[model samples]
Target: MSIELLTLCLILSVFLVFVTGLPVAFSLGSVSMLFTIFLWGPHSLQLITHAALGSMTSFMLVAIPLFILMGNILERSGLAETLFKMVYLWMGPVKGGLAIGTVVICTAMAAMVGVIGAGIVTMGVIALPSMLRRGYNKELAMGAIMAGGALGALIPPSVAMILYSSLGKLSIGKMFLGGIIPGLILSFLYMAFIWIKCYLNPSAGPALSSEETVTWRQKFAALRDSILPMALIVLVLGSIFIGAATPTEASAVGAFGAFLTTVFYRKFSWRMLKEACFRTLKLFSMVMWILIGASCFSRFYMAMGAADLVKGLVTGSGINPWLIIIGMQISLIVLGMLMEDYAIIMIAAPIYIPIVTALGFDPLWFGILFIINMQIAVLTPPYGFALFYMKGLSNEITMAQLYRSIIPFVPLQAVGLVLVMIFPKIALWLPGLMFE
Candidate 1:
């Protein structure tokens, strides 16, 4: 058979395996291995081994485990809780105060820990109970946590951006910096939606009593708690942007900083260290497995010339590259509604990235757009992991209620995505300044 037919069959086989509900890494790796051996002979296994070793040994990927460990340690140390309490006192008592605090806390957590799970679970436990107790609308309360937590993936030091940079072969520095502005924009979008929604319907998000509001004196004191955390984030991120350290080295710095922060707070303990390390190992293992599978699958597909196929088809179809880019975004949306963001990134990104670059696109700009799409994807119906995550934390929230709460936020995520799409500078400018 021709390479084209082999590529087609390989892709179809992967989809079939996915549909069969095999674990994502297994699905990709097994499908690729099956095709490689049966069709191309046993020697094809060497390709799988090479791909696995190359992917696993990546220096950039080392940052993944370190950053993940940092996030876990931060969450386990009670520092995130202290940070939230600080923000809560300052921001609470306004309209939708707790919801707003969730955004602030999630952003702060994003700076410290780059994983969505950290933000999601931390806020789900800490912020969710407070919002519910304050008589906030269930959906709004849940939406705030879910929406804000997803920001971790876009913000600097973001493990999602780490993987995105890895797959897209873009600058990890620029990608991290590029995500900072947009991450803040996404956070503000959540905050704006909170303000507008609560303003229109006061009953949905009730304001706290004047008694709950912090006096100026108390606010000033609370600022001390935030100062150290904010400084650490700035110090870590700044070092990477200013060329003081590579992303992996910065990850090392971040982990050490988080440790010191925890110790400085007197929250560090053997128990916390053990728990953090365990969690990091688990998270790291999951992503590494996925990476291995994606490596093997991409290798197999490329061997069959699928990348060239996609490039040729898109170009020869006589479609404008801009329109094709739009089409790619739409496909992501549809798949986002169905698949986990990790699965989408691992499986589809390999195919899509080559087509994007071949069309004269900047992968950095496209990475931001892709991250924005993932922010929206977390809110999409039927299978969005963020929605499910929030639901698990909230006993009173129904699926329908959770879905409705995200309705407005979804459009806002799309607006952010479109913003990146149009203004490449939102992603490219900061990185450009940094490199130049």
Candidate 2:
């Protein structure tokens, strides 16, 4: 069969299986196995074992479970509540202050945890009720929490970055550093959007009533509670930045520090520890399976000459490389609506990274762009993971409302992606300064 026919069949089969509602990992693995048997006979099925083993033994992947454990512990540790209280005390008096504070706390939590679900669910539970009770616009309140929480995907110590870097053979430390500015810029844009929206329509996000306002002493007390998490964020990311530890070693530090945090907060218990460990295991297992399945699928697809075919097509077409890059981003956004970010990374990274590098663009910059697009993906409609996460937080929110809530923020994310694309320096400068 022609390479194009093989590629078409592979993609269609995966989508057909996905429509049957099997898990992504199983769908990918099953399709790849069938294809291997058909094209190269059953003997070639041994390649699947090798791909699974390779994914299992990757040293960098060790960071994933550790990071997830840290995030789970911190989620139950009352750290997010304390950080929200601190932000509320300081920003609650201003128009749209609560929403703005949600974004800020999300940014801080992103630094501390570096996982999207933890931030979204924690803030949705902690901040959403407060915003509604204060009469904040439903869309504004929901959008803020979702957009801000997604920051975990871009901020330092991100699990997605770790996975992408591991797959692409990029520097994990440089990827972490590269994300800092873009994450902050996106955070800032979210806050600015809230402020401006409330400014134009004061009733949309009114300031806290006089009875709910706190004194300076209480505000300062709330501020004190944030110091520990801030310090932990510093210790983890700082260790990686200064070469004191690799990302894996830093993840261990983060997990330990997160334990100490719960102890210091008096929230630690054997139950909490067991729960965190169990949750970590489940999340890690899901990631590993997807990695293994994707590894096999990509390995077979490449063996069919898909990568070379794609490279030849793009290079031979004579299209502006920038336009091709934009087209790739658009296709990824469409994929995001239908697929999980992990699946997208697994399937697309191998094909896309080589093409971008061959075009003389830095793969590191493209990786950041890819992640930002995934961040937007989680907020998109129909099948967005963030939308589903938000829905699970409360039954009062319909899927339609959840979809509308993200309309404003998705554009903001797209704008952020474009900014990084236009000025590569935004993503590249920090990594260059630190790693070069």
Candidate 3:
């Protein structure tokens, strides 16, 4: 069969399996196995073994589970609640203070833990109810939590960025640094929208009543509780920025610091530690299996000459490179609706990275831009992980309402994505300043 025909068959088969509700890891692995046996004979099954082994043995990937453990530990230890309380108390006097404070707390959480699940669930459980009880608009309140929770994917220590960096052969440290400015930009944009919207429409987020106010002494007490946790964030991120540690080493320090913070808060127990370890293993296992499956699929994809076919078409099209980049971003948004970030990165990065490099664009910049799109994908309707997480947390909120809430934040995310694209320096500048 022709290479094009084989590629079409493989892609269609994979899509059909996914549509049938087979797990992503199994779908990719099974499809790759069938193709390998048919095309390369049964003796060639060792290719799958080698690919899985190689991906699992990657040294940088060690950071993923450790960072996950760190996030899980802090989460179980009540760090999110404490941070929310601190920010809410401080910002409560301002218009739309609760919403603004939620965003700020999410940003801090992102700096500490680079996954969205813990932050979203924590904030959803804690801040969402508070906002609702205080006469805040449900859509505005939900939007802030979902959007802010999604920030963890864009911020440093991000496991998603780690996977992309490792696969794309970009520097993890540089990718981590590149994400900072853009993440903060998007975060600030969310805060700005909340402030302005509430300012214009007082009914959306009213200022707290005098009876709800905390004395200056009470505010100081709140600040005191948060100091150690804030310092933990600085210790982890600061160590990476100052050249004191590699990302993997920094992850270890983060995990240890999170445990110590729990001890300080007196929230530590044997059960808490066991739960953190168990959750880490579950999440880690899922991520690694997908990585192994995607590796097998990509190996078969190359064997089938799909990468070459794409290179030829892209290089021969004579189209503007920028247009191709835009097209790639659009495809990511569409595919993101159907797939998780890891699956999307695994399938697309191998095909797209070479094209990006061929066009003389910086891969690191494109990686940051891609991460921003993933943030938006998580909040989008019908299949967004964040939207489902919101619904699961609050039975009172309908799926339609959750979808409606995220609509406004979508464009704000795009604006951030465009800014990074138009001025690559926004992503590159911090990394360059630190490393170059």
Compared with the true structure, what per-residue lDDT tens digits does model 3 show for residues 266-334? 999999999999999998899998999999998888877877888887889999999999999999999
Scored by lDDT, model 1 comes in at 0.85
TM-score of each: 0.97, 0.98, 0.98
Candidate ranking (lDDT, best to worst): 2, 3, 1
In angstroms, the error of model 3 at 281 is 1.3
lDDT (10s digit) by residue, model 2, range 1-436: 8988889999999999999999998999999999999999999998887888888999999998988888889888778899999999999999999999999999998987778888999999999999999999999999999999999999988989998998899999999999999999999999999999999999989999998859999998999988998899999999999889999999999999999999998989998899889888888888899999999988888888877898888789999999989999999999999998999999899889988987889999999999999998899866789998999988899987888889889999999999999999999999888877
Model 2 worst lDDT window (10 residues): 298-307
In angstroms, the error of model 2 at 331 is: 0.4
After TM-score superposition, the amount by which residue 230's alpha carbon in candidate 2 deviates from its true location, in angstroms, is 0.6
Over 1-436, each residue of candidate 1 has an lDDT whose tens digit, in order, gives 8777877787688789888899889999998898889877998799999999999889999998888888888899887777777777777777887898888899888888888878988898988888888888878888888888889889988888888889878889999989988989889988998999889998878887766656788877778877877888888889999999999998998889888988998889999999999999988898889989999998888887786688779879998899989998999999889877877888777888888888898888888888878777877988788888877875777888888888878888888888888888888888888899
Higher lDDT: candidate 1 or 3?
3
Q: Candidate 1 clashing pairs? A: none
List candidate 1 segments past 4 Å from native: none
Q: Supply the global lDDT for candidate 3.
A: 0.91
Model 2 alpha-carbon drift over 4 Å, by segment: none
